[model samples]
Target: MTAELNARLEPTGERWTLVFIRELRKPPEEVWGALTDPGRLERWAPFTAERDLGTTGDTTLTMIDGDESTPLPATVRRAEPPHLLEYTWGDDLLRWELEPSGAGTLLTLRHTLPGEDGLGPMVASGWHLCLDVMERLLDGEDVRAVRGEEAKEHGWEDLRDRYAKMFAG
Candidate 1:
């Protein structure tokens, strides 16, 4: 299946915010579980949650691949369950907002980066694949985590080129 690259980039002061909006066929609560539950996240997320992330606290996010799969310290800035969640990962902040839309959930992800720095398209491409995997999972389809060479093999390079053009101006 062809992945859809539907993220928007906005300049926010010294930083740039990349927003990904998705309309899921599942409800907010179900989507929330996928976002917070470790078991469900492992099927789609790029990292595994070491603990429950439904509360505002600290947790470890273990990288799913790479030799540097070491757990990273992460802080939950806010959590509202089935609605809103904000957290920090490395030098960036990630926020997820869910809202009921029709019979499904409208999920919005706001990823704040220090700067555009030519990484916007690359990052957007990665998130595009992750979100695609998540949506497929929610739809009850068997999907594997896409990354590295697998990502490029599955049209990630095309997405990167599209996003690069989108973020160019």
Candidate 2:
């Protein structure tokens, strides 16, 4: 939870959107692999994609929330391996952009929600912890995915409050 908040919000009509950025100490290819591969995703992401997200096609992702699982019908609208990938999980769009930065990879995640429900802080905090878990997994550290209700054990509430203040001021 001590990690700096790296999320910014923009109002688009009646919808709310946020961009979460993370710098990983790995190449784009490696980072991309983590993003598209199902196994790698399970190691960090809160949801699990049924197939490799590196391809442009239809796929299903299951969002894990405690003991409940929500099946989200998704489609990969754009897929440029090792660089950019855009997909839809249900009605939400998730666009990922990766760029090489001094032997590392700069990851940018653009997530758009349905409405301006003041949920930016909650979403940003979730992504923050997920990205942190991803970074550690990329570094060969054995860490499980920290997400959903379980994220509270990993300081999600604190992150949410911190992000709320950040977005407010």
What tens-digit string does per-residue lDDT give for candidate 2 at 1-169? 3457788888767787798888889999999999999999989998999999999999899999888889999999999989999999998889999999999998999999887748999999899999999998898999888868899998899989998998898
TM-score versus the correct structure, for each prediction: 0.92, 0.96
- Model 2 spans with C-alpha error above 4 angstroms: none
Superposed by TM-score, candidate 1 places the C-alpha of residue 26 at a distance from the truth, in angstroms, of: 0.7
* Runs with alpha carbons beyond 4 Å of true place in candidate 1: 66-68
For model 2 the TM-score comes to: 0.96
Clashing pairs in 1: none
Residue 78, model 2: Cα distance from true site in angstroms: 0.7
| TM-score of decoy 1 | 0.92
Evaluate residue 3 in candidate 1 and report its C-alpha lDDT on the 0 to 100 scale: 52
